[model samples]
Structure formats: C-alpha cells, structure tokens
Target: MSGHGEAQPMKSRKSGPLRGVAEVPGDKSISHRSLIFGAMAVGETRITGLLEGQDVLDTAKAMRAFGATVTRLGEGAWTVNGVGVGGFREPEDVIDCGNSGTGVRLIMGTMATAPITATFTGDASLRKRPMGRVTDPLALFGARAYGRQGGRLPMTVVGAANPVPVRYALPVASAQVKSAVLLAGLNAPGETVVIEKEPTRDHSERMLLGFGARLSVEKTGEGHVITLTGQPELRPQTVAVPRDPSSAAFPVCAALIVEGSDITVPGVSQNLTRNGLYLTLVEMGAEIDFLNPREEGGEPVADLRVRFSGEMKGIEVPPERAPSMIDEYPVLSVVAAFATGKTVMRGVKELRVKESDRIDAMARGLEACGVRIEEDEDTLIVHGMGPGGVPGGATCATHIDHRIAMSFLVCGLAAKAEIAVDDGSPIQTSFPVFLPLMNGLGASLTAG
Candidate 1:
C-alpha cells in the first residue's frame, strides 16, 4: 500500500492566535443533495454557492451518467436539467464515486428502486469503509446488492423492478442511510417512513421538500419520524447552499485554541441538527458567539465570532447529539487536547467505519502527541492537557484520511513543539484552501 504512491510529509509549527474572516465553502451534504434532487426533478435546477469539492463533483458526474444535463457555469454556480421523476437512463459504465461514502451510498439508494443495474467503486480509502449499513436498508425496497467480503466496495446493485416502500428505524445516527432510503422511495409507490433513534443532519429531508417533493418530518417519542410520498412530480428550484458547519469547525477550532486570535466565519449553517459541536465548545467555555442570526436557502444560519479562549474546560458530549456533529469529532478531539479536564464522546461506533478508523486514528495520534486518551468500541475519552500543555513533537499517521490530517495540523498550532503528518493531499477532498487559509491566519504549516 505504501508503494502505491510517494508519501508526502507536512509539518506545522506553533503559531499565534488565528485572526481573520473565514468564508468557508458551501455545505457538502446540501451540495450533494442539490445535484441528486435536481437530476430527479421535472425542470432545470439552478444552484449557487455549491461546494466544488471532490465528493460533490463525483455526485455531479453520477447525475450526468443518469441522463441529467449537469453543467458548470462558473465558480460555485451550476445548473442541472433533469430527466424528470422515474426517468433515469441505464448507464453503460461503472459509477465510480471516488473517495466519497456519501456519494456512493446515497446514489445507490437513489438507483435501488429503479429498474437499473449499476456497479459502484471508489478510492482505496473509501473502498475500506463499510457499505452494509446502506445495503441492508435498501434491501427492504426490493433491491439486490452483491459486494465483496464484509460489504466493502466494488459492488453491484440491481435495482427493484416493482419497488415497495418501507418504514425503517435507523439503528445508528446516519444522514446518508436515511437519505438513501428517502431517495429510493421517490420512484416507489405509496409512502416511505423512516424513524431515527437519534437526530442526524436533516439536509436531505429539508431539500426534498424545497424541490417540491411531498416530505414531512415530525418529532416523536421514538425519535424523528420522517415520511415521504412517492412518485410525485418534483419541480426544480434554485438553491443557495449555506456554508458547511463541519468545514467551518477547522478554522473555528484553530482560532479558539491559538493564542491572541479572533476570527469571524460568516454564513455558517446553524441548523439545529448540525450545531452540536459549537454548542459543546461553548459549554466548554470557548469564546464563541453568533452574530446576525438569519435564514438563507430555507435553513437557519449565522455569522460566528470566535476568539481565543485559554480557559476552556472539557465536558461530556451527549450521545444524542452525535448525528448533528458526526463529521466534526476529529476536529473536536483536536480542540479537546487544549482544554482542561476530560472530554468524553459516547455512542459513536459508526466512526469506526468511516474513511479511516477515526476513533483509533484519533486516539493513537493524540497519545503520540503526549496527550492521554481512552477508547472502546463506541466511546472516546480525552484527558485534555489544558491550554498550551500539549507536547507535540510526534508525527501523526493520517492513514489517507483527510479529516485526520487536518485535525493533527490544527493540534500543532498551540502545541509546545512542531507536529507532522504522513500525507496532506487528502485535505483537498473537502477543504482545498485549508493550508492557505490557516497560513493566512499566521499558522506555520510547511510541506516537506
């Protein structure tokens, strides 16, 4: 595996507090959904501020393969002319989703209820992630999937000819799984219901409704109960995707941990389902506040004013909030190292099967940097070293995971010594301007 490509090492040195405005790109989840929904709509869908990340780009390509006329107009602007509901054409070639689990899983769900046969594959890191969670639920819609051992990638999905709607209770807090089933239900008859034991990001549900799909969401004792009516003529509409809070976490955390730093990240999605990390950080006494709370693209958003907080105290993150902040645990762990006391994250076993074994990767990397941590199958406990107490002479192993590489780079800012990572190229998957943005904020990151 090491010989497949030349390894690049990058190092980061201690820096003063990060200060400036961070205008992060659009939300990744929403960007992906916009393309998928646009492809299934009856007319042209125009989108602005779309995240031009590799993951979202892969979804755009998949939409084009399904006969949608996807066109890039300019920076952060795209248009998709749909083939209408139940009008997807059978692709003659494989659907390669690259390194995006979201792209593959959600696309698989969308194609499952149709009468098409498609094969899915991805990069080395994405292929290692589990697909069983998606395939198991999709089987209820009369779809058939066959994959390698352990439900790894390079799989073929045979869609349902006569699909049946299903009511599924999510075993884990995953927006991708929920979105997949919901997308599959668009071509099926009758109503499809999904119950979440814990709330995840609701971008899929909200965007479906925005595109004129018949979708409703209600809070129930069991969890969030979502219902979708099938075979509706989805009318396309213009979409303005908000800045991703998950991507915003990197710069926000860096500013909070670094000394004498103050920054503002504008137009961040503050959707209640996705602000759990910022809430946890505020509870830990970080100097974060919302400015100009407003609505955009039918979602709640805010401009976050973050400043350096040296007296952060760690706190237990409620397990119920996992779905809202699932993609942020890696950056949260980096921030935790600078806090006092212990930060405990529970009910996150799903982290084990992401692009990398996130729990193991974070635990090992933190330990290597002279911070203490304990982990199990579903929980991670970090004994924070307080502000500026981290001894960071270690070179962290990123294991080809983008978040891991970025997280370690954030840790090096307030650490006593410099920190290094095995590779930094994967950061382009989501935040391509990460290093330049951080460097502009006075971070000393160097490529070797």
Candidate 2:
C-alpha cells in the first residue's frame, strides 16, 4: 500500500515578489491514461513526461499486476509491454491503489469484461470515497461488484464471462465515470454508446482514437453521444504528455495575488475542457498572456505569462464550466480572497465528493484566515478581501486532499500573517515537487 508517512505540518509566510519560470509536472489525467492504455495495447508503448506522483504511480503498479510489464526507463520515461485487450491475467494479490480514486476506478472498468476476478483497496481517504458511480454502470455490462455497504473500496469485481455492450447516460458530470464506461466498452462485442448531458474531459476519447480504436463522437440535441466499437487490436505509440494545467494552477494563481509577482508557465495544456480556471482568472482582470499557442501530444498547449494585478474583480463562474474546472475551485477560491467583490462558484456539487468535501474544507479554512465566505450544497460564494486584505494566521486541516493543501499554502504567500496546513503530506499524491517549485519562485514555505 502507498503511504505518506506522518503528518508534516507546513507553514507559509508573506513573501516578496515571485519571478521565474514554473515548469509544473506532466498532466496527471494523461499520465494515468497513458499507463492504462499502454497496458492494453499489443506492443511496447513508450511514454515521456509522465507524472510520477503517487496517483499515477499506483496506476503503473496496477498495470503491472494485470500482466503488463511496466518499467521506468528513467525520470519521466516509461515503457509498457502490453498484454493487449481482453488478455489481462488475474492478479495474485489484492490491488492496493493507495490514494488514487482515478487509478482504482479506471482499472475496475478495464478488467470488467475479462474473465477475471480482482479485489481493489486504497488508503483511508480513497476508501471513504463512493465507488458506486463506476460500479453501477459496470453492472450494465454484466460485471458484478461486491464491496462494503455504500460501494466503498476493498471491493471485488467479478468480470463477465459473456459481456455485452451497454448504453449509459451519465447521471452526473464526471470524467472518471465517463472514462470507466468507455474503457469497459473496449472489451464488449458490439458498439457501446455513452451519452453525457454535459461534456466532460475528452482525454479518454482522444487517446482511444490516437491508439487506433474505431470510435466516433456525435453531438445531438441530447448532448455528446460517444460510440466505441469494442475489442480492437490497439496499436502502441510513443506518448509525450503535456504539463498539467491543474498543477500549474497553484503557481499561476499564487502569482496573481502576490504583489509584484511575475512568472511564466511553459507547455501547459490549454485543452478547452481544462482551461476554465484560466478563463475565470482572466474574467477577474488577471493580467495573463497566452503566449505561443500550439499543439503537443494531440492536445493544445501554450505558455502563460502571469503578473500580479491589484485590480482583479470577482465574477460569477457559469455553472456549465464546473466539469472542466472541478479540481481547481479550491485554489480559485484562494485567488478570490485577494480580488474585490464576491466570486461565486455554482454547479459545483461535485466538489463535495472529491478527495474531501472541498466546499466545506475551503470555506472553513478561508473563514479561519479572516475571509468571509458563504456555501450551501451546490454553491460557494467567496467574498473577496481585496488586495493584501487576508489576515492569515490559522492552521487549516488538509483532510488528505492535495489541492486543499497546496491552495492554503499559496494563500499564506500573500496573507498578512503566516498560514499553516495541519498536514502537507497529501500534496505528494499529485504535485510532489510543489514546495520546491514554489520556493524556487521566491515564495516562503517551510515544513516542521
């Protein structure tokens, strides 16, 4: 099982201007998919710029357990000798996905149509999360799942001996759920279709096409209808992952609030589905320039030049943009505290089911830092304290959420007093180099 060791309390203090280039880690979403898809291909698939965080690493381990020979060549380079689709071997031991909900959920779908039985578990934080979202759909393909009540982990999946294709319409907006159904569809016999009322991230669809799957997406009056012809001989290809915009959000947002800060983030994915935070920031009067926009790894990429602006004003984030920026609201809330007026985030009921109840977590933490906030089941309204208005002498509970940990740390860099997180260890799950990267950019962060 993956372990973060002990609680490492960390604090951040008001710092001077931050100026530098922040090359954040590879995209976490793409990293996990690369390993999974590679393992499903027929030949060796090589990947570069893969995120080496715990979540992606756990996915790599799970791929190996399913009979793929996944190896790290060095740094961010990896090679996977796939067992091909419908060829996964039953694992000899329990699959411990650690703190990764993405890893376990996607893997469950990948093996759902094969004639194998596998049990999955994770860390305390991941185990508390609901897995029913994925399992409920998998049942349509003749997969049987039995776990603790409420569909928690330490669960076993009995793959279907005679699996059939399914047509599932998303009950909610979730990339994880959408990806799982698409993966399971790869093993069933006919064309499997999935309908989404709202378009989620299309990484799975894009990657599946890149790997030579017969898939097509159509947009009708009822939303996006995705059809995948099941059981293709997936071809292996070299994958180069773009830098993560989600991980880049920390430094990009930190620069927006810290007076005199100027920083550039290079090669970050500007995928339309993932750039909602950037759009929202620009709407608030943030001085960010999208430089040298181009394509990389089948996705749009760009360089971001951000400068500290004291004139930012909050705006209501459209509810439709929620699926694209769900993982970013915590840090966006931090930026809101430094802007003028209220920044309202709606259609974010999904925030309540992430690594933690993010709405409650950020609300309490911001409130403790002397920032007025209002939140209900589906909305969060952060009344901005304006430039340098946050008086931040408080210790915020991390709740084992990586984004929550990094968001509060960024908050301290501009607050009047220091801000501390009760446990910073969770940051390793996604952005392992978060501290060094921010500190190198002149932010004041320390662990004790």
Candidate 3:
C-alpha cells in the first residue's frame, strides 16, 4: 500500500543554451543491484554514489522489510548488513517498489526461490507495466506468480522450496528479464544459463561477478550465453556507482543543439555496452571529445566536453546498438530534429513497452514542433531540420513519463518559438535535480 501518493501535473517552457558542468546522479541500474546484492551477502556491503531518486529509495525500504539492515550514512553513502545468501526472512508486510520496474522485477527474482510468499505493488505507471515478461521466466524456476490481468502489478509471488535452475533464451532484448533469472538462479542447484540474442545492459552479470558469485559470460555464434553457478556463498564488497549516462544525455544533447553553448560532464560511464548515443551523435557530426578517459568502479569513465554544432547530419542507427542506448532514444530523437537528412532508428520494438509508448510520444511531440517523423512496428525515422531550422511553438503531452517531459524541454532550448509540456512532475522519479541543475547551467526553464 505504499504507492498512495497522487500524481501532480506541471508544465515547462522554452529555455536557452544550457551551459556549465553537470554532475548527474549515480547509475540507477547499478544502484538497485547494489542494494539487492548487499542484502544477500554475508557481511556488510558499503555503497557510495547511490542514486537518491524515489525509485531507488523504495528499493532500500524493500530490502529492510525482507530482514536486511539498510542504513543511509550520508549523501550518496549507504551500508547494508546482509542476511546471507539464500537466507531471506518472510516480510511481515507487502513490498512496494514505487515507479521502478527494475526494482520490483529484480526483487521478485531474488525472493522467488526462498520458500516465502510476498505481495508486491507499485505506482499507477508501474502497475500498468507488464510483469509477465519477468513472471513468465520466474515460473520456469518453479516459482508461482499470480497478478492482475495482463500480468500487471499488485501481484503475489510464492517462492519455491526447491527451485530448479533453467536455461532461458530471451525472446526479446530485456535486461530486467535477464537479471531476474540470474538472481533466482543464485539459490537453486546447478547452473542457470541465459542466452540473449541481442545484448542488453550487463550490469547484473558484472555486479554478480563483483560480489563473488560464480558467473561467466561467453559470446556464442547465436548470442551472448551467460552461465551462473548456483548456491554460492556471496561476499560483500564496497561499491562505487558510476554516473548515469542516460541522465547525462539531456544536458549533452542540449549543449550540442543550443547555439553558443559549451559544457562538460564529468565521470560519465563510457562502457562500450552503454555509450551508443555518444557514438551515434559523433557520427552525426557533433563536436564532442572524451577527455581523461580512465576506469572507475570497474567501468570506463570519461569527461565529456560538448560544444554547439551547427552542421549535424543524420545517420541510420544500427539495430545492434539498441541495447547500448535504449533509454536515450527519447533524447536522441530530440537531437535528430536539429540535424540534416533523415535519422532512421530500427529494431526498437521495445519502445512500445517502456514507461510509455516512447516512439509515439516522440513522434507526436516532434511533429507538433514542425519535425516530420514516421514509425512502424519496430522502426522510427526522423526528418531533420538542418541547424536552427526548427519552428517549435508547440505543447507536448508527457503521459506521466519523465524522459518524455525532459526530452521535450530540451527541444525548447534551441527552438525559434517557446515549447511546453503537459506534465513535468514525473522528473522526480529519476532526476529530481534536473530543473535546478540545468537552470544553474544557464538554461531558462520555468515551471508554468
């Protein structure tokens, strides 16, 4: 019953060139994993740079309910005293993951093999999302999940006393489904194998290895095959989460499209598996440089310096790079509106099932702003405006999605006329400091 808060409606106006350095929050995927892994470890796990967003905070609370001692030391610092692997106690209350699909899905997998029953629910947006993608896989692990129609939330998961390990070939490219199976396999006997035809975010696999779980990744001719040895005694370690590249996309794209703008974003994760947007932008003739590239927390880190570019040419984004930059498509579409030629993005059927129909959202909003776009079942093509050619007197409908709201706001920065969005309140789910941070960087955003 934790998702009792009502949605608030808000709007945003046109802005100017976003300037100065921006320090985005820690990666959301890593933050959620740190808490879950820490809860399952034998000893204390220290975490630094954890995202303090509402979604992540809800996960922290859920961990505590499952008998783990989670404490917040200070800003971006947390500690979890774990209950040991395969040793979760039945929660006395329901688990509420708020608006985080990552949180609820992974937690379901973590608790699905422990011989306990737990009810899970979330906010309106999360409740509407299909949990069938995760529950269907968990069912193969001997867990019983019963939810509302279409496998939506407000569901109950009954863990199996003796779970069976499974070798699941993902039907689609979904990191959540992949991570769920891996987490459930940690308590089963024998090896749990997952074959992903298209590589998604490998945060769960990477973090599992970091936590001393017996996990390995091998690339097969067909796809990436990941095998995890079950029932290992996991050891806790200190974790430093990397800055989110998805959140960094807004400022980076804004600087590239806004005239007379130069900005630097430090400590951004440049994992080849997650930097597709930057690579695609470079191919579009953006003036961006990777400065002082180094490693941080076992991930590639770099300082991104972006300057205003007046001559951007659109390029066809390959399907192979979809997993690397799935969350960035909304912002990328915004950038494409200012580029010359057509930007074609294919093999993105996953967009239909995100927080909202991201393809329809971007296509509708961009069209209102005088940008031509077309969409099929799994493809989107944008006809660009060639350098400052956008006539952006429009109001976009956000449908309670944070990325949709933020992407349209960035479009307003370089537009000839002011732009507006129906709702900006959803920004708190991920980047709560977005408006103030961008305003500090000299962007003229006002709450209308």
TM-scores, all models, native as reference: 0.97, 0.99, 0.97
Query: How does each model score on lDDT?
Result: 0.90, 0.94, 0.90
Candidate 3 residue spans exceeding 4 A from truth: 1-15
- Is candidate 2 or 3 superior in TM-score? 2
> 55-105, model 2: which lDDT tens digit per residue?
999899999999999999999999999999999999999999888888999
Clashing pairs in 1: none
Candidate maximizing TM-score? 2
Candidate 2 Cα outliers beyond 4 Å, as residue runs = none
Encode model 1's per-residue lDDT on 28-134: one tens digit a residue: 88999999999999889999999998888889999999899999999989999998877888888889888798999999999999899999998888888889989
- Candidate numbers sorted by TM-score from highest down: 2, 1, 3
Look at candidate 3 and give me any clashing residue pairs. none
What are the RMSDs of all candidates, in order? 1.8, 0.7, 1.5
What are the runs in model 1 whose C-alpha is more than 4 Å off? 1-7
